[model samples]
Target chain A: MATTPDLTKHRKMHRGSRAGIARRGHTVAFGQFGLQALERCWMTTRQIEAARQTITRTMKRRGKLWIRIFPQKSYTKKPLEVRMGKGKAGIEDWVAVIRPANMLFEVDGVPEVVAKAGMRLAAAKLPIRTRFVVRGRA
Target chain B: MKSVALEAFPRAAAKRNAVKKLRAGGRVPGVLYGREGSPRAVEVDQKALETLVHHATSETVLVDLSLQGASHLALLQEVQHHPISGSFLHVDLHAVRADEKVTVSVPVEAVGEPVGVKTGGGVLEHVMFKLKVRALPKDLPEIIHVDVTGLEVDKSIHIGEIQPAAGVEILGNPGFAVFSVAIPKAEEAKPTEAVAVEGAAPVEGGEAGAAGAKAEAGKAEGAADAKKADGKKAPEAKAKGK
Candidate 1:
């Protein structure tokens, strides 16, 4: 999992899947907006508090927005273990991991919502992105 | 609907002064809360209470309201608001049947982006407007949808991902996105600023690079300090437990 952090740096990136381009769909740039990160689900009590401080101090004030981000951790238990073998090459197996990261945020004003959110992301260096914008309907 | 025998009282009955004020203004204050028994009322607004009810839990819930007339049986459904001003809207309600199941939409939460996080350095996003569901009054859920399986960055998720319990039926579109993940590009990642050295032997003009780094750091620090000078501080308060 730790290999080739820079591999994608060379490959041309686009929006949607390969099939989309094949059907005359050009991939738009993904996450053209902000900071992003990959972290374990579990956070210590201290880590959580620290994160809250970072978001509120920087994002809320300058951004003029209220954000709600909730990070979560998950784990899996496996039965396999490594045992000493003298004669042959060691063997290994593949496995998967999973977790959730639900969060939400809101801004008071219009247009400013996205701009402030963007500014907050820059200041906080948080690992999040803006996906879509919707208007509240009457 | 599974019927529940609920006991409710007025939320504002103790505020006699407020009631007096409302009575004088001709806006009756009332509450509508009940599962089995009739809804109680101290005073109900022909307009305001109706608007508040528009946003409340439905009739199966035990609402404690007051009215000028006797208490009655009812369920809350809708809350009306000013479309542009976004003020508190009037509430709508229905008289509940003990044996009937009421359907309402609850909220769903999704965390993290799958596609964006994996490839584009983007993260997951959520815009969970709401999800409608049907359940008996006795079986109401404050929130639902715990499992978030196939989500990825750049990929949108819908209501179909929710795993409803045996007795409940979800009433929204299967393609609804309670949450999603994406990288909409809010910032750019410039090369990390270099560390500065003080009076150290420069290697092949390393001093120039160091000077540039110091300048960037100064700029960043200046930005941070300016925030403090503005008297705009974040809440130094700690996070409370759920």
Candidate 2:
């Protein structure tokens, strides 16, 4: 199933800044270990799904995965031969604006090695650089 | 709980720029207060503070702070760190007397392998990672260990069932769940099927589906227009990109 938001007030939105570090959702809140983003990027639903699938497959569904960021922002794209003066195009895709230090994924109920391996595999499917973080310390 | 000896010097500079200068000079500026007279600003070496934090087993650490000529037993209440670098920025130490009781959150550790996880292919979930407890400085524990050897599938251990250390009073809700063994996610019943079976009646007519689809389309268009009328609300993106 598509991982877009069920209901959005806005069909399309202007591209916002992705410069600063994440103020919140930066810690490994819900799990023993987490995959923290080291760079800012627009994380599409497909990338998130691909990373989630990779992690779940690597872990063999032994642990629980928490997706911290939701793709609430809608990005629109114009079709072929579209005029510049026309209104905003239909929503092409949904994306989550991720910043540095934002925790993208968290997994628990698995060993540290297994969780680390799963996060490493999942990070390969993402655009931003990521670091593996434990619960207590950064 | 082990009382680690840490040395602190009186911080003469209390201004914001001075604190920044102190941090630049490899010192973590901190405040010491509690059942004492006034809050004293002190600074500890950044390396020593980091070492103490790294080696500590739990968040709650008891330290014997030697300042000037007197020895003060203090609880490491809060330590702020730089978000990205994870470097220690500042610290707060609450001095405690031997007779006074202090409340702190202690980390909970699962001790043994659960039978449900071993035999029934269940996942062990650590529900409550930390427990709040009130105790004297000497009786305070660094971490609380709960044995889960006999825990079965779909069973949980509550806070009331676990035993506390001597002179330590567990402070939170007694019925709060600490740990549980749940069946694997794949085996869990699907929510859609459950809702269909229990809540909604079967829709046999195509008319109803067609009408619902039309209503949904109308709602979407109205929502889009309404959203456009008001300025587009972006997600909590603090930074402005060019």
Candidate 3:
């Protein structure tokens, strides 16, 4: 299973500045063959899990896989007919707030053709749109 | 500035599979582009090339490349590494004459802490990491060091201010800033509050007006506190007191 940390009892983080869309580290994380998101979207923990499973299964453990993003931001929701001003709703799930040009997954040690095919299958499990990218001359 | 001797063999085939085969055999495929001739495909031992690159102190390395019973002086131009594994993939070497001048980017390093950052509550910002310099192959310095100890707040070191080593000429706009000492963002936002209080004290008319002005200042302070609590336009609180 993909790693997920137990972040219970964590103090509520102050609503900080929005993640700048043009930041550097938001791009590709690891490996040469990867998928870059073209649109900003949120990837829930379960969705990321499904994508990870799809990629590893497709590759058949032949090469290395790197999940560049993590669902660290805690998301919350309120129940129906709830009154206003009750502090905050309990944490429901975790999500990664991904922006454009953010690399969602990467594969290495495999041929370019195999990595592309495997990443295509993984991209099907995600809600946001992504494009295949190859590490080339920068 | 140091020269390392390495042996390379001319690759028989220029096909993709042949390059992969060379890599699998613990060799890195490379190309040596000469000044007046077509590029030649060469393969160097992976371990030797990696060690030479790792030990080299500068971005530009003088390579005494031996290939097919002939040796040529070259400069290591570019290196490609596997994105994940950090292993050498391919390298580009450019043939150079020992007496000719070559332009290369040398890393700029700061040697001392600026007084503005150390005692004046300012921050030192390094604007340039690498500087382009043209010099003879023998006179190239590994790295350029800038002494920043004399820098004061609001002062900056420009490209024109730096003294390059003899026979080396820096290539860029002379006025382009290389490094600077500037007030920190948090400190830059602080002086307006003091200005507002000083501006208000002299404008009051009489004793009764002074009391009313004090009440207004207290109300403004309360509004500023409320704005801070709401986490919106906290900096505007200082502007509002004016």
Candidate 4:
């Protein structure tokens, strides 16, 4: 076998001066490979119910768990699933619903502002058994 | 400015194996630094990081991060994902004001089933996940909706379809293609000429007729199964990532 020179000294892209921010942990999770199993429980009762309804509708469409809400709203109000009769124009600001057990999850016009409140909502209101999934991209 | 009390710490020693092991336990290593704040290293839960990424638009989220019982307000600055397989590796959080106007990407969503889909056998496709926009700290969007119900197969839905909220402004080209309705891709199709060539063998000869027919039938069945499966798995992968 021909003796190959040690390539260890050959500079690779990962290490250099002013190096790209070091991977704090493993670069393992970056843009997750294959599929990422992420289950986010609704933190509040309203959030839980809303997420459940959303998922129900989403299941009818594409099954890819793709939902993005701008100006994400706070899940503080009661999620009204009841019809107000003949285009009553039931107004809504922010909402998300997911029923994983039944294979469903949905979100409508969620804003980013509620991202903070969502943490609280997730901690305070999500249903005991509710779950939602999304593709992981590191 | 409504400032959040976010905690700051120095980065942990950079070592591949150490990070993989730590993150496996849900502890993500993160860095924090920006105007008026010094840099530090910190560790946050893996689950918490994923939740924030999903719910928040970008590294633009305000984290009232607490470290060693001390808290400081910060913005989700940068999130690094693995190139081939998208996975969260390290997140960069920039401590900022609770009410500051920051620029970030907000997902642009299509609302209502497309007319192209209703009249045509088309499925809704989302081309953009987040649109870059500028807004106050409180005006970020988890996602934006664009209605495609009126569209036809020849027509398309673009970033122009997105309607910005008050105090929020979209930053991408208004004409960028968000999604469209078109014919679905056909797979595993054999040429007509090829079929004719094979068919001629059976009619032109008689002894191998039974075997040829069975082979052709099996190939058709396999193609049907493949189509059914293609639609099923793409969404599954998205679900797992989310």
> Which number leads on DockQ?
2
Sorting all predicted structures by TM-score, with the top scorer first, yields 2, 3, 4, 1
lDDT of 4 at A2: 11
Show the colliding residue pairs in model 3: none
In the range A1-138, model 4's lDDT, one tens digit per residue, is 011213434222221132232223222121111111133232333444444333322232322222221212222222356444553342233322221222222322222223223323332344443222232323
Estimate, for each residue in B110-216, the C-alpha lDDT of model 3 and write its tens digit.
78888987778665666776799999888888899999999998999999999999999999999998888776432233244434555432212222243457689
Q: What are the candidates' individual DockQ scores?
A: 0.02, 0.29, 0.03, 0.05
> What DockQ number belongs to candidate 3?
0.03
| Alpha-carbon lDDT, every model | 0.41, 0.85, 0.74, 0.50
Q: Model 4 in CAPRI terms: which quality? A: incorrect
What tens digits encode model 1's per-residue C-alpha lDDT throughout B1-242?
22222233343543778665765564544445446556545344445544433443332233432333344335555444332233333344455554577777665544332544555554455456457778665565655645434566557766776777766778877887666655433222221221243333232124345446768999999988888855543433222221
Interface RMSD of each: 17.1, 7.0, 21.4, 13.8
For each candidate, give the TM-score of chain B.
Answer: 0.47, 0.75, 0.74, 0.62
Candidates, ranked, DockQ:
2, 4, 3, 1
CA deviation > 4 Å runs, candidate 4: A1-138, B1-12, B15-26, B47-60, B67-71, B79-88, B185-242
> Which of the two, 2 or 3, has more DockQ?
2
TM-score of 2: 0.82
Model 4: per-residue Cα lDDT at residue B31:
81
DockQ of 4: 0.05
Q: C-alpha displacement of B45 in model 1, angstroms?
A: 12
By lDDT, the candidates rank as 2, 3, 4, 1
Using lDDT, give the best candidate's number. Answer: 2
* Model 3 chain A poorest ten-residue lDDT run: A11-20
| Candidate with better DockQ, 1 vs 2 | 2
lDDT of 4 by residue, B102-133 (tens): 77766565677777777765545555666788
